[model samples]
Structure formats: C-alpha cells, structure tokens
Target: MSLPFSPQSSLHQRLRVGLGTMLVPLIMLAGGALISFEGAVGSFEQQDSISRQALFPLAEVEGEILELTSVATHAQPTNTMTLQNYRRKQLVIKSQLALLSDYFQGQPTKFNSVQEIRRQWLEIARLCEQIFEATEPEQLANAKVQLSQRLQGILKNTQELNYRLIAFQNEANFDKARAVREKVRYLVAFISLLALALALLFAFYLSRSITDPLQTLAKGVEKLGQGELHHRITLETQDEFNHLAETFNLMANQLEQSQQDLYRLATLDGLTEVYNRREFNRWLLVEIERSQRGEHPVSLIMVDIDHFKRLNDTYGHQAGDLALCEVAQLLQREVRPGDIVCRYGGEEFGVILPKATSADSWVIAERIRLAIAEKSVVLPSQQHIDMTASLGVATYPDHADCKERLVKQADQALYTAKYQGRNRVHSAEVNECNHQINKLQRMLVKQGT
Candidate 1:
C-alpha cells in the first residue's frame, strides 16, 4: 500500500529536534539565575557589614578621649598618669585615622563617602598633634577643648555621610535583585510552555515518521517484485528513520543493476565483445524458426585469419590478442545491426545476418576481408604488420535446417578459401579479390626474416 502522507514534511521533525537542543540550555539558564540571586543577596549583607565596621574605629577613639578628659577634671592625676593618658588618646586617634584611610582606598569613587571620611580623619589627626605639643595645664585645657570640638564635628559629618552611602547602595542592590527575580519568573513560565509544546510536536512527528517510510518501502518492494525497477523512495529528513529509507532505495537500485549485469555477462563474449557461442546458437535457432514460419532468407558467415598459427608465431601472442580486438571492431563496423557476430574460438569469428541471401552475405564477407587487408596493426616500436583473413558464407533454410549444420557448411567454405588461396572470400564458390594481400604480407615477412 502507498503511504498515507509524504515523508518530506520536515517542519514537524525540525521542531522536535530543536526542542531537544533547547532543553539543556533552559536548565542551565534557570540554574544560573538562581546563583545570581544568591550572590546579590550575599553582596547586600557584606556591604552593610563593611559600612558598620568603618564606624567602629572612630567610635573607639572618641570613647577613650572622653574618658581621659573626665579624669583630668575629677581624679587626682599623677604627671606620669596624665601624660600616659594623653599619649594613649593620641595613639588611638592616629590608629583610627589610618583605618579610615584604608577603608576609603577600595571604593569605586572616592568623592562623597571617601572624601568626607578623609577630611574628618585629618581634623582628628591635627587635634592629636596640638595635644602632643601642649606645655601647661591651661594649654592642655585649651588643647582638650580643640580636640573635643574637632572630634564632635568629625563624628557628625561621618555619621551623615555613612548613612547616605549605605542607603544608596541598598537601593541599588534592591533594584538589581528585583530585576533578576522578574527574569527568573518569566523564564520559568516560558520554559514550561516550551516543554509542553516540544513534547506534543515530538510525539506527533516521531509517530508519523515511523509509519510513513514503512508504507513507502512496502509499495516500493511490491513494484520491484513486479519488475518496475524504477521505483524509488524519497525522504527529506536527516534523522535515523530517513537514513533507513535512503538505504532501502540504494539497495533497490543495486539489485536492478545486478540483474542487468548478469544478463549481459551470460550473453556476451568476454574477449571479442560479440555474442557468446550460446547466444549465437540461440540466435541461429530463432532465425531458423522464423524462416520455417515465414519462409524468410537467412545467411551465416564463418571467418578465420589465414595462417593464424604462422602469424602468432611470427608476431608475439600479444599481437594475436590485438588481432582479435581489431577483428571484433571490424565485424561490428562492417555488419548490419540485425547481424549477430560471435567469437567461435581462438582465431575464428562467426556472423548471422537474418533475411540476407547467400549473395548479400558474400558481399558483407568480402567487405570484412578487404577491410582487414587494408589496415595494418602498428606496435609501440614503430613496427607495422599487414594481416589478411578468409571468409565463408552459407544461406540458411536453403543449404541447411539445424544451426549446427549451417555452421558446418560455412566452415567447409572457409576451408576451401584457405586451400585455394589464403586471403580471399569464398561463399558457395571462390571469388577472386582484385586487391594485393601479398605485397604487404611479403614486406612483413621480410622484416621478420
């Protein structure tokens, strides 16, 4: 039976294949989105932690300075204790300023957050320097007032700056996180729809492919059995099922060619390229049958190169092979299309021309003889040798009935041609050739001698 639908509908198959390709990438995109979301959240937390850490060093220095000022006002302080307290406050402020500078160094833009922090840190460092240079109690008191005022100013400025920076960074993080979440949501929905669509397309496409080629193959096989050898399967897809269809088509083609080759090889003579003896026998029998039915004339010709043995001995065996090939060409060229030529054996050639009288066969046989006489076989060494052949012809349904008897009569005529003179045509009677075969042959013989 024929296929319900053609196999060349590739759109559905392509959609199925495309779906398989997209599946893995969709999974990877989803996983990558999840990782990005986690990284954004982690970054927000770290930023908050770092901003808080930036404040700690300043706060610690201010607390120590306040303690030292209170002790100078209320407690009985030894000189060494006062000086020691003063030294400790100076060292702490310097250390805090160094930490603040380190924090500002890593920021993208050192404009607001970094510049304000640095300015405040510089004022604190100047105050600590003034305290270190103080010589009297009143001088120390004045230095403490300057240090306290500078510290309070630094704290206020840094606090406001830090607050604004942290707020801006958090807003950016929130926006980015929201964008990533929306992308994930959209991607998930799209993938769900895509997966469903892909599954449906794949199932339909695969099911159709499975049945269509089998149906085509079945129809093609039936046609092949009936000897309609031109039947072929057409497949459009590059997938496995299509590959199988192509293979089936190729097998059918080879099978058809194999049958033709076997028929030819069985009927053809391998060396001379004429019909083999079996084919010659069959053709002669058919001609005889036709003659018996319609009373049509048929003729047979048997040809052999004269002194074939002496020729092969004088020239080499390879030259004898060339002689056969050249003779086959001459036969095909000289005989009519209806004529059948066969290589009878080593140095013998045969011909069957239907509807030809003995007279017509004689003319063709003489033509072949003259054609061979006119041409010489040339070798690669600039050596050329002339050759000649004798022909015998017999009329069919007149002289004989069976194919074997027709051939025998032709052979007898050929023997007569050889006996009377080696290079001439003899059919029913000897016919004198006006050409000189001996002139060329005599030259060749001299060269050989």
Candidate 2:
C-alpha cells in the first residue's frame, strides 16, 4: 500500500533530482529515504502506528550506517566513487534521523536516545573523514579498524533505541507523535499537492530543454550520415550539451574539409588546377548519357599546345608548367559554366560541351585557339613566352555515338590541324573521319612498336 499523505507521490521517481554538497564520498544515489518512505508507510500497523513509523526508518538508518562503515573500510582508497556514495548516503541517513527526532519531542528520556544517536553520528562522520583521508595502507588499516568498532557501537545504541521505541517509553511521546502525525498529514497533503504541480511543470520544462537539443543533434547526425557535410548542430543551453554540440560541429567541419581535399587530390590536375584526365573521361561519359536521354547534341574539343616540346626545350620545364596553368585558366574563363575544361594529358586539354551543336563547338574551338595564341605566359626569370594551340572539334552522333569513337575523331582532327600547321582549329569532317581514325591508330601502333 502507498502512503496516504499527498507528499508521498513518486514524483521523485519520475522526475530525477540531484543534490550536491561536500560531506563524504562515492556516487548517484541522492534520495534513498524516499524509497524507504514507501516501505515505512506500508509497514505501519494501525494498532501501533507510532512505533512502526519511527522504528522502521530507524532500523533502516542503522543498517545503512553499518553498510557505509563496511563500504568505507573495504573500498579502495583511491576510488572517487566510494566517497561520493558515502556522502550521499550520509545525507540520506541524516534525513532519516531528522524524521525520527520529530517523534521524540516532549519526551526527555526517549529524546536523549535520539541525541546520543546524533552524537554517535558525529563521531562516525569523523571516522569517515579519517578513513577517506588516509593515504597509506597502515593509516587506512587503523582507520578501518576504528570505524568498524565505532559503527558496531552506533548499531548497538540504535538497537537499544529501537527496543525503547517499541516498548513505548512515554504516553506523552505517543500522544505527541499521534498529534504530530495529524498535523503532518494535513501539511504533507498541501505540500504534496504543491510538489506535484511543480514536478509536472519541471518535468515538462526539463523534457523540452534536454530533448529538443538532443533531437537537433540526432538530426544533424543523420544529415552527416547522408553526406550533407555542411550540416551543424545548434545547442544553446549553457551546459554540457552546448559543449557536446560544439564537438560534433568541429568533427563535421574537419570531415568536410578532409573530403574536399581528397576530392581535389583525386580529380584536379596538380599543376593546372583544371579537371584532370580521369575526371574528364568520367564527365565525357556522363554528358554523353545526358545528351542521349535529351536527344540533344554533345561536342568534344581536343586541344594540344603547338610545339610544346620545343617550348620546354627552349624555356625549361618550369616555363612549360606555367604556360599550362595560364592556358587552363584562360580556357576556364572562355567557356560557359556548363562546359568542363580538363587537362587531358601532357601538353593536351579536353573540353566537354553538352547540348551544343557542331557549329557552336567550332566557334568555341576557334575562340580557345585565338586565346592561346594571344596569351603570353611570364616565366620565373621575368621572360614572356607566347604559346599557341591546335584545336579539334567533334560533335556527338555527328562524329560517332560512342565516347571512344568521338575521342578518336577529335584526336584525328587535331592531328590533321597539326599536320597542316600548328596554331589553328579543325572540325572533324564526317566524310573521312573513320579513315583518318584508322590511319591514326595504325600510326600509333607503329610508334608503340
């Protein structure tokens, strides 16, 4: 059976509370008397309500004291948790003593027992300090032996008080306990009502306060998992939750930066900062697929720096690298956002133009060729070097549907431009593109051998 007093609700069990103060050692148990209260209320017999109420909690307090002594004596001296629990249980036992003390008012003889118990508790607490504060094995061993004896004496006195409480030492103590219970019953009833309301309000506020940030953090984690690298957690509580949110955001930032570094290393040219050959090939296939779906034309322009070997031979490799970077940046400026400019290979670049016609691509190729011929790259020694490029433009479905065939057609046209003269643009003529491609392949095979 539960307590009839309104203050007796499990509001405590439902809404967790923590209390902190400096007394002793060990850990999370803050309110154990409340747990014992239910038992105290249930263990009461109507025939002798005073004896049961006072004696039950008293016996529990005695037991807890013994347990604390055992724990203090045997527990590791370095264990921080032992001290925290010892402190918390000490408070709990203190509360129990307070409740029992209330029952002995006006009865001097019975009340002295309560006073002696309090005195013994002070001695026990002193022992507790000595036990926890002891650093060496010898000091700790002496403290433990003394604490065990002190607790045994405390327990013996507590038992005597229990026997006297059961015997009903005075009619005044009984009559007062009964009168006090009535007043307390009404007082607890009112306070319990107030406490219930407060607990509900606190529960609502605490739930929102704690759960809202946790929900935000949980959602942020989910977004990060789905590759939303820019996602961050926003916890505004000036507490540990805020610190946790900061840690999570920091982790996300580092991960996003790491991913970007990896992406650049994988797909961008080291020297030119343009899309590299690998990315170019990948985007070429992607653009072709998009064009196939839309039934729109896609174009490829293959550009090669004219007499690049001669430039390196004359100016040095550093100048050649500078020229490549300058040309790549110029190509990027000349093209639309939709177009992709890539460093195709040594002294070569490829441009993918989606949804563009052969005529459009031809104009772009001419513009690129003109830009390369006009731009002068400054060398490290303050020397200027003018570079020129030969460009070959080929349209998809006009040149060939496959990426390989399209590349071959553009490459062959570029060869044809170089064959006629170096700094000019040539479009792949469909009439002889296959013949030119076969001839180029045969030449490449011969060069390989």
Candidate 3:
C-alpha cells in the first residue's frame, strides 16, 4: 500500500514546479535585460544624439564662413553692393559662432577652439573691410592676402574637430551596441539551453513516474490473466499512480480469492468436503500415467460405506451426509501427505497413492477400514451408530495398467469384500487377502491408540 500524497507530491504540483524551474531563469534574464537596456542603453542613445547634434552647429559655422569668403573674393573691387553683402553676412556669422561657443561651454578644449575661431573671424572681417574700402589694386591685393592666410588656420581647426566628433560617436554608440548585442545573445542562449535541459530532466521524471507504474500494473494484470492468483504489485510514488497501484493490487487479491472459491465449488464435494468424482477420475488418470513409467508404482483404494442404503432408510438423508463427512475426514487424516481422497460417488470414495505398492495399499486400506468401524455418526434424532467401510486395494503394473482397469479392478475387489463380510480390506493382487487384515489390526493396537 502507498502513503497518501502531500501537496508537493501531487501531479499538478510537480508540473507547476517543472514549469517554474524552466521559466524562472528566463524570466529573470528578460527582466534584467529590460532594466539594463532601459537605463544604460537609453543614456547611450541620448549621448549619441547629443554628440551628433554638437557637429551640426560646427558645420553651420563652417558653411557661413565659406559663403562670406566666396562673396568677398568674387566681388568687384570698387562695388558698394558687394561690400554691403559682406557686412550683412559677417554679422550673421558672428551671431551663429556665439551660440556655438555657448553650446561647447562644458568642454574646455572645444570651447578654446571656438574662441580661437572667433579671434580669427574678427581678423578676417577687418581685412575684408579693408579690401572693400581699397580702390588701388595694390591695396586690394594686400588685404585679400591677409584674409586668405587667416582662413587657412580656422578651416583646418574646424575640420579636425568635426573628424574627432565622428570618431567619438562611433566609439560611444556602435561599439557599445555590439557589446550589448553579444551580452544579450549569451544570456538568451544560456537561458534557453537551461530551460531545455530542465524540461528534458522533468520529462524523464514524469515518464518513469507514469510509465513504470503502468508497466508494473500491466504485467500484474497479465499474470493474473494467465491464472497466477498470487501475483502482487509494489509501488512507492507518493501520488495518484501509487494509489492506483494499490487499488489494482487489491483487485488482484480479490480476483485470486474468487478464483479459489470457484475452484472449490467446481471440484470439491459439497457434502463430504473432499474432491468430487470428476477430479477423482482426472487424478486417477494422472497417477496411472505416472505409474506407467515403471520406476514407481501407484495404488488406489476404493472404499464403500457398508449398509449406507440401510442407514439412510433407518435415520435420514442428513445422517447419511454426516456419516459421509465423518468417513471422508477419517480417510484424509489417515492418508499420507501425497495421498488423494475423493468422493467417487454416493457413499463411495477413492484414495490415490502415487508411490505405494500393493502391500502398502493393503495396509492403508485396512487402516481406513479399522478407522471407519471405530467412528460413530450421530443422527438428527441424537442416536449414535457405529460405521464401517469396505476397501479394495489395487496397484498399477500388477492388477491394472490404465486408469479404467485400475478403477475396475479396485471396484471388483470392493464388491468382493462387501460380498464376503462388508467390513474387510480386499486386494486385487491377492487371491485371499485375509492374512494382512489381522496383522494390520495388531499393528494399529500397538501404536498406543
């Protein structure tokens, strides 16, 4: 029998545990990744945008300077319209640079670079104003020469800063993004593999828990089906499968008991509680076949209750039944363990001895006769009557070879014993069979009976 299941031992509980074990790590991994990306990666995204934005202002300043230099170089030397355009463009460029300077206040390096560019811009504007005022070719050429020299230093500084900002964005965003993706891959792979392994482990557990018990039960049922009435099952799982195993074993026990009951009903004599006539004939055949091998001879003693018809007429059928039961009990008690006693018919019995000779048969038959004569049966009216039986002994390979001949010879000897005196042992192997009766009587008396 199995113990009852605790909550933890329940099937549903086990399933829940398996699922939780498989999913918990993945869940934690997902949650951790989400939190890390939200805080750290969000910060990186904002920094990446700010770095790209920083370049926009610098690029605008460079474009404005280039446009002003172009207008100055292409202008007619004596044209007032060109000078007006240069003055308006110069004011706009200075205003834009001031905003760019404020944007770089957090970095001293970039702020210093913007301050240098501002100084250079003021120098370039003064030379351009000189070129616009000059009418002589020598004066114009001298002012343009100074403007070109200042533009070279400021343009180089701006382009170099722009290259540095591009390199910073690549380092800050692309490299970190690759590292984050690799970390995610490792986490996902680890969680997926762990969950798969756990799933496989639990699958094996469930299979054994489920299929092992089922196989045991199936084997038990098969044995029972094959008429093995003593087969049983054992299981120790603290779950419904164990309970089912216990139930199946219980059912097998009941089925075995029922089969025994059926066998008793079919093969036992109801009145005498001995084997019935059908079993007697079947066993006789079996014994005869064994004796045919010639190594060990078998014997049979056919017994009939003397004066049974007269007893039934005198008392009642119940008295006759009691006498039969008493005689059967006495025969069973006197016989050896290997001997078989059967109610051959109404008031008649057969004893099969597997390895007994004719002499042994005669002795056992006489003992049975003496035991029957001493036994007393009480009628329903409370009257006691002494009973006696006539037995005929026959041995295989001497009196008969087959079951039919053995039983026929024993029956003939029985008829002869009854005809002679009705309470004597007769043997088919002997002509008189009178010598052993008195000898067995003396032997029984000397046994402290």
Candidate 4:
C-alpha cells in the first residue's frame, strides 16, 4: 500500500510518505476488523450453544414418550416395572412442558397452542397417577387412550418448537456472520481504493515535480551548448532539485566561458596573437590539395625578418616581439582573400596563395618584401628601426611535390636569397640545384684551363 504524503522535504519524497501513510492506517483497520469479526463469531457460537442446551431436554422427553407408548402397546402383559416406567415418563413429559413454557415465556402468542398442549399433557400426567393407583382393565384402557393422545400432541409441539427455535437462531447467526463478513470485505475494498488513489496522487505529484525541473534543466543545457551562456533555469523550491538545477546552470556558464577561452586559444598564436605555425601548415596543405584536385596552380611564399636575432640583441626581447607583430600586420594587409598569411616561426612567416602561378607568387612575395621594407617601428629607445625581409617562392608540381616539401624548398630558396643578398625575392627555379651544378661545372672547367 502507498500513502499520499512526502517522505522528506525533497523532490522524490512523496512516494515514500504515500506508501507509509497508506500502510499504517490500513494495517490498523484490518487488525481491528479481524478482531471484531472474531468477537462476532464467538457471540454466534455462544448463542448456538445456549439454543442447543435449551432444546436437548425436550428431545430427551420426546424419546421417553415414544418408548413408553411402544411398551404399553407391544407387551402382552403389563409388569410393575413397566407401570413405574410409564409413570416416570409421564412426570418427565410434564417437566419438559414446563421448561418449554419458560423457554417461550416472552412470546405468549407463539406458545398459545403449545400451552394448550401442555394443559392436555398435565391431564395425561394425572391419568398416569391414576394408573399407578389402580390395577383395573377398564380404567387402564380409558386412561391409556387419553394419555397417549395428549402426550403425542404435546411431544410433537415441543419438538416442533425446539426445531423452529434452533433453525431461527441458526439463520439469524448465519445472516449476522455473513453481514459482518461483507462489512469486512467492504472495508478492505475501501482501504484498497484509498491506497490506490493515494498512490496515484503521490506518483502524479512526484512525477510532475521531477519532470518539470528536468525539462527546464534539459533546455538550459541545450541552450548553453549552443553558446547561450547567460541562460539559467529557475528553482521554484528550496530542495535538492533546486540545488542541482543551480549547479547545472553554474556548470553551463563555466563551460561556455571555457569554450570561449578554447576558441581564442585555437585561433590566436600563443605569443603573437597572429596565425601560428600550425595554421600556416594547414593553409599550405589546403591550398595544395585544392590545387591538385581542381588542377589549379598553388604557390607558397616563405619570408624571414632580416637579422632578427641581432635586432633582438640590439634592443630588448620586447622590441623584437613588437617588430614581429608590426611585420605580421604589414604582411596581412598586403595579402588578399584566398591568400594565407601566418607566422611560420619566431622571426619567420609564410603565405599560401591558391590559383596563383610561380610568376604571380614571386610578384606577391616581392610586394610583401617591399611593404615590410617601407614600414618602420619605434624601438624601446624611441629611435626608428628599419628592417627588410627575404622571401622565397615555390609552386605546386613545379618546384616540389607535396605541401610540406614545397614549403621547405621555398624556405631553402629563402636561405639562398639571404645568402646571395640580404633582402630580395628568390625563386626555386632560379636556385634549382641543377643550375648551381652547371655553374660549378663551368667554374671547374675555367679552373682547369
């Protein structure tokens, strides 16, 4: 059985209290009804026993009458013992009649016929007294006829009344027992109905409470996932459910802030707030794949600040950082959309241009070199510092095969540019390793001559 109250001041408490309340009252009522039914049964048994005791004497007297009558008619000759038995049986019949009168004393009308039968039985008793006094034939015959008739009627009435009274008491007790049983059944049904109703009510309340908050929290979590950090679910109650909702809201807000922080971390270079080396590699690979798939020409331009370490040594590390930022911004301004500019390393940067051939890439690299050359930055000493960059250009499937190799070969060309001159645009085709081999061969021939 379930009760309709909450167990504690919590969200799911109704179920606990509902069952407890229903069980307590139902157990008490069931026990009380059982005891009441048992008491009723005891009373019914006691009444039955009293009725049986009252009827037993009548049954015994009727048996004696039958026996005496049989003896008087069947025996060929009457003996003194028979005479004494007849007289004693007549006396017992009168006594049973008196007892029946007393048993039916309250209902005078019900016993009127039996009372007349009792009066006739009294006459029969007087006749038996006469029989005991005389030993004559004519008197015995008349007395016998009168006594048999009266006694027969009286015995029949007494037995009939006893049977009727026993039957009536039995039926009354049975009806009472049945009624009590039905009452018990009804009480049990009522209790069960009450318990069922309470259980449903408690379930409804608990489910409503739990689901409402859960729905709110679910929506809140979803919105927070979609970047709505300011959303919070309301707590309508002062309970653990409310606390959980509050915590969820807090966690959602924290997660949104964390997501923002991660976004910033992902997009910005850790030191320079420009594109990082990973971004440069990603752009180069994307451009290479796009060019190969679409049959478009892609180009990579590698740039390095001139004497960056010497500049860092001349000024402080902070000035070197400012110089890098200024150079990165200048390079970004010089590039177009679909052109990638990233800080390749500490004092190096890279650009990947999609659909650009070697000549176009070389021209863009030269422009970037000239742009950086034109720009000047104020050092920590409040003096203007002028710097230049060396650039190298390489095209897909022309100077290198893969994006990484292309970028590396361009970086080698940039090294060549730095070696050949301090600041300039150099092409992989110009250095082309084979060109140097031919130049060295020409030099060896000249030395041999």
Candidate 5:
C-alpha cells in the first residue's frame, strides 16, 4: 500500500510534511542547546560587567584616598585649601562606593565587600576632618599622626579588595575559556548531525519535487528553440516552477508576436508605413524580370512634394512630416491593388504599376497630384496647411527597357515637371525628342554617321 504522505502528493503538501518532520526535532535540539549556552554566556557577561564598572571605579577611589592622605599630613596649620582638597576627595570616594554598591546589588557577597570598604572610607574621612578642625601647632601634629594611621588601614582594605577582584576575574576567564571549548564541541557535533539530516532530506525532496519538473521544462525549452513557438509548459504542482512555466509561456507568446511585427517593419517604411526603398527596389527588379519574359510594359511614377522645404520653414517640420504622410495615404488610396506604392526617399515617392502603359501611369500620377492639392493637413497647433505635388511617369520597353534606366528616365521627367512649375505631371514619352537627339549623338560617335 502507498504511504499517506508520498512523493506523488502535491509539492506544497510534501514540503509541509517534510518541514514538519525535519524542523520539530531540530528546533527541540537547538532549544536545549541554546538554554545551556545562554546560561554560560550570562555568567561570562556578569563577570565582565563587575570588572569594568565596579573594580575600575574602586581602584580610582583608592588612588584618590592615598592622595588625600598625603595632602592632609603635609598641610601647614593655616592652609584652608588643604581642608578643601580633603573634603573633595572624601566626596568622590563616597560617590564611587555608592556606584559600586549599585553594580553589585544582585550579589550579596560582592555588595558586602563594597559595604566594608565604604565603612573604612568613612573612618578615614573622619580623621581628615579632625585634621582640618585642629588649629594649634600641637593639635595639628597629633591629627596628622591619626590621619596617617587611618590611611594605612584604608589602604590595606583597598589592596585586599583589589586582590579579591583580580582573583575572581581570573576564575571567570578560566570558566569562560572552558565554556567556549565545550560550546564549540557541542555545536560542531549538533550542526554536523543536523546538516547531514538536512542534506539527505533536501536531496530526496529535490529529486522528487524539482528534478522532474525542470527536466520537463528543459524539454519544452528545447522544443521552443527548435521553432515550436506554440509549445507550452504545463506544471500542476502550483509551486514557483509552475509560475516560471506560466511566465515562460507568456514570453513565448510575446516572442512570436514580436517576430511577426519585426517582419512587417522590415518590409514597410517607418514613417509612411508603405513599402520602403529597399523593398521597392526588390519588387521593381522582380517586376522588370517578369515584364522582360512576357514582353509586357511596366510603368514607374516618381513623385516629389513641391516646395516641401519652404513648407517646413513656414509651418515647421512637423507639418511637413504630416504632409508627407498625408500624400502617401492619398497615393495609396488612388493606386490600384496591383500597383505598389513606396517611399522612395526623403520627400519623394515611387509607384510601380505592373502591365500598365505610360498613359495609364500618367493618369494615376495626375490623380494623386490633384488629390494632394485638394487635401489640407491639420498640424498639432490646430492650423491647416494646403500642399501640392509634382509627378513624372515612365514606362519600360519604351523608355530605356531596363530597371535602372527606366527609374532614371522617370526621375528626369520629374525634374522637368518641377522646372515647368510645380503641381504638374509629365512623361518620358513627351521628352522623346531629347532621348532621340542623345541616341543620334551616340550613334555619330560610334560610326561617324
């Protein structure tokens, strides 16, 4: 029979069960270890606190007492400043002893020692006071003897306390060192066992939970790389890997859409969204080859926006761009489905009419010119600008019979239309006289005819 909690269960259920089984024992072990360690640590901190706050202040007070005793013994009978110094030292020593009492309040033994020191200090202060009160030379000399004896007693007590604190501190250091050694050994053993258990659990969980899903995802990725854009990753565990699969599916969809958009951008113009110059050249070459094989005519019309620079200077470049786009839209609308419209260059456009003659191309060009002349482009400033265009038409097998020459002939015709006053359509056939004269000149050069 299968177990109640098995590998075939959901990843969340498996993870919950695994963590519950693993962490309970680990936490129990860690709790016991922490309690022991914290007790040792607390003892070490208390020793450190007593040494810094209590012992150091006690030493300072002892030094002050010695200084006061020396000053009291050597003071002249009328030197009031000596009494003031003695009073100041007495006050400082009392304050330090009070502070030490506060630090050792929790320990009855240490507090008792501080109380003993305070009692001895009070006796010494009383002797200093007696010396301050003595006025006669004989009285001052006797007070100095008593003050010296009181100082000796206080010094002996202070030395004893200092030695006790040092011994206690050394014992604390030894205990701290031993505790640290024991803690290190326990921690190493406990952590090694815990880590070993966790490593085994993790290895088992990873193989069950992650490895199969990742292998499936890897295969999906391989399929996607091989152009299986429609392929998707399906995971049912509802884990992070499931989320990753969903994101991967989204990325694949976006990539497929982006590829389509990129292909469209490659063949279309960025501004006018018509066939770009490169695409135009490619289409024209294909049309020319087909025309040559069929002995049929193919026409090309070249268009220019007349006074476009002046329009840009007058209204701004934005208006000029709008005008260009509007003109492209007009040409696209007027041209037949079989014809291809292209943005030839800056402020110029070309249309390829397959199986069309010069007359038909010229008529279409004239229609485009009229449409542009009637159209008004509204600028971003809410201003309208009217514009016009010049067109030139040329046909293959009648105008140079080759793609390059046909385009050149059309361009030349366009130049003539611009020179004859803008907003007009002209044809290469209308300029046949110039072509015949050039041909005769070439023949003359070749044969002296």
Candidate 6:
C-alpha cells in the first residue's frame, strides 16, 4: 500500500511551516521579556515618586518645626512679628502634612502613619499658639519654656518617624531590587532556552532549504557584477528566494530602461520636446571648436515671441503656452536637418546652424519668422490667435569669433528687430553706422539703386 505525495512535503511549504511554527513563540518570548522589564522599571519609579511626594515633604515639615522652636526660645517677650513668623512656619507644616495624606490616600498603612504625624504636628502648633497669646512677662517666659520642651519632645518623635520611614523605604527598595534581579535571571534563562531552540530549528531549516539557493544566488550576482545582465537565478523550491530572483531580473530590466530615459530627459526640453538649453550650449561649444579647426562658419539665430507677455495677460498662460509650442514647431519645420533648435528660455528660442554662413542663416531666420507670423494657435476655447516672432542672425568668424560674442551679437540683432518692428529678421552685421549709411544709400537708391 502506498500513500499520496503532499504539497506540504515540498521545500517551500516546509520552510513556511517551520518559520510559522517558530514565529509565534519568538514573538511571545520578546513580548514577555518587554513586559517583565517594564513592570520592574515601573515599580521602581512608583516607589521613587512616593518618596518624593511624601517623605521629602515630611523632612521639610521637621525643618520648619525646628525653626519655629528656635524663634520661641530666643525671642525676649516675643513680638507680634515673631509670633507671625511662628504661625507661618506652623501653617507650612500643616500644609505639608495635608499633602502627605493625599499622597498616601489608598494605602491604609502609610495613611495611618501620616495621621499619627499630623496629630503630633497639631499639638506642637497649639503650643506655639499658646506661646503667642501669653502677654505678661512672667506668663510669656513660662510659655516659652513650655513650648521649647514640647517642641523637643515632638522633634524626638518626628526624628523617630523619619528614621522609620527611611528604613521602610530602604527595605522596600531592597525587595524590589531582589524581585527585579530574579526576574532578569529567569528571563535570561528563558531567552537562552528559546534562542537555543530557535537556533537548532534555523540550523536545520537552513541546511535543508537555504544553503543551495543562497549559493546559486551568489553566483548569479557575481555574473551580474561582471555585466552579464541576462544571467538569472534558478531555484526549484518556489520559495521567497525564487521570488527575489525574479524581482532582481525585473530590476535589471528597469535599470536599463531608466538609463535610456535619463539620457533623453537630460538632452531634451520637457515641454517643447526639442534640444534644451544645456544640450544647446554643449552643441554650440562643439560646433565652435569645429568651425575654428575647419575654418568654416557656424550661425546662431536668436528669436523672441513678440508681445508674449501681453498675449499671456490677454488670453491666459495656457493660450501663451500654445503660441510658444506653435512657434517652436514652425522653427523646427523651417530649419535644415543639420540645424538644431532649442527652447533657450521662456518666450525665446535659439537655432544653431553648423557650417552655415551669415547670408544662409538670415534666409533661414526670415523663413522661420514668416512661418510663425502665418501660423495661428487654436486654444481650448476654440479661439484662433495669430502670433509673430522677431529673429536675429549672427554667424561665427563673420559676426564674432567666439561662441559668447556670437550669441551676444545675435541677441543685439534680435533687440534691434524688436525695436524696429515686430515680425522682422535682422542681421548682426547691420551696426548703427552701417544702418545710417545704408539709409542714405537707400534714399538715393529710391531714385533706383
């Protein structure tokens, strides 16, 4: 006769069963340990609080009583001020006794002691009052003597009570300490036993289930470290380690994809999806060096949207963004394949033309300006808004030698275009002197040049 194979006999199931069986006991052990420690600590703290609340005030009461006794014995025909001082000390003693009573409310034993002390304190207070009321010199002297003797007796009793309280507190503290020590000893033994049992269970389970999977995983990790990203761990147990291996493979795939995505994001603008300012600068520097070495030309065109702020204020930012995107698309459509267009900044765009002369760049900029002027952006409100762009063209080694100077010249040209009129293209070569001379020549040429 043969029995059927159970899934519980599998390695994964055995691991789960073993961990589940141990987990509850381990948790119970930890919880019990924490509770025991907290109980011990709480007991110590409660005892200390009682000492501070009751015993400390009792000591203060004894001190105040002694001060009152000194005043009664030393004052010659005690004055009203001396009596007032004595009464004040008496009241302080009474208040402290009342507080002590409150502190020992639930405990009959401590409360009884507090009552006894209070009774003694009241007798001393009465003696003090009698000393204060005596008016005649002889009567005052006698009252003073009597109050001193009475205070001595009460002080003796109080010292004895204080000693007893100290002894009791010390004994209670010793008992608590012994109990805590025993608890710690028992807990240590229990923890040692529990740990030993758990260790044996872990050793058995690790030997049976984990060692081979860990070795395989280590090898797979080594392969991954060696750049073999396609390598994968194989495990037949279908346990957590198998799941972890699958996650590792997924992570590798995601890491590869993320690298490509990061590269694209770094090089391209988020909104316009064109070369960003950073990429444009990088390309411009490379193009400048190439032009310097080859003795060829590189051109830069700076374009600004005309009345963009007014457009934003009139139709809102959403409409303004649509206009900018439309302008970017027009620029992209007008430029050659080798030319790079970038959203240089808000309401501004830059075009980098490699190996293109100033004349070539001016023609391209004019075409871009005309295309942007013709295009109309449709808003979410179904309203069509026409927009225009001002463009400035400057070429490397022709307008300026370096990248920075060339960009500056182009920017100046763009400023001139905006100053002259909107929707126009201007070249950097047209300086103020050249412009004046050209104006005179144009006037003469109006007859025909």
Q: Write the per-residue lDDT of candidate 6 for residues 1-449, one digit (tens) a residue.
A: 11111212445555665666567567767777787889889999998887777678888988998888778776543487787787688778889889878988898877887788788777766666666676777887777777777778777867876887789889999999998989877886787688778767765764656666778888888987887766776676455677877888787677667766786799988778888899989999999999867868899999999999999999999998888888888888899998999988999999999999988998999889888888999999899998899999998776775678888999999999999987899999745565566446645855685
In the range 189-236, model 4's lDDT, one tens digit per residue, is 776677677656766777776677778888888887787887888866
> What's the TM for model 5?
0.45
- Worst 10 contiguous positions by lDDT, candidate 1: 430-439
lDDT (Cα, tens digit) per residue for candidate 3, span 1-449: 22112322756666666666667667767876786577557767787778756788778878877777777786665787887888787888788778778978988988888888899889988888788778898888888877787777778887887887788778877777877777777766776677667767776775665677789888988997898879888876667767777888899889888988999989999888899999999998888777655558899999999999999998878888899999999999999998999999999999999999999989999998998898899776778999888999888756764689789889999999999999999998543344355345535865767
TM-scores for all candidates?
Answer: 0.49, 0.57, 0.67, 0.51, 0.45, 0.44
Superposition error at 159 for model 2 (Å): 52
Deviation (Å) of 276 in candidate 3 = 1.0
Candidate 4: C-alpha lDDT? 0.76
Ranking by lDDT: 5, 3, 6, 2, 4, 1
Worst 10 residues of 6 by lDDT: 1-10
Better of 3 and 6 by lDDT: 3
Candidate achieving higher lDDT, 1 or 4: 4
Q: Considering lDDT, which of the candidate structures 2 and 5 is the better prediction for this target?
A: 5
| Positional deviation of residue 384's Cα in model 5 after best superposition, in angstroms | 2.2
Q: Write the per-residue lDDT of candidate 5 for residues 116-168, one digit (tens) a residue.
A: 88888787777666666777878878878887887888788888888888898
The order by descending TM-score is 3, 2, 4, 1, 5, 6
| Candidate 2 lDDT by residue in tens digits, 131-190 | 788888898888788878878888898999887776673664566567656655665555
Candidate 1 vs. true structure, TM-score:
0.49
Among all candidates shown, the one with the greatest lDDT:
5
* Sliding window of 10 residues with minimal summed lDDT for model 5: 1-10
Q: Candidate 3 at residue 106, lDDT?
A: 89
Of 5 and 6, the candidate ahead on lDDT is 5
lDDT of each: 0.72, 0.80, 0.81, 0.76, 0.83, 0.80
Residue 232 lDDT (model 5): 90
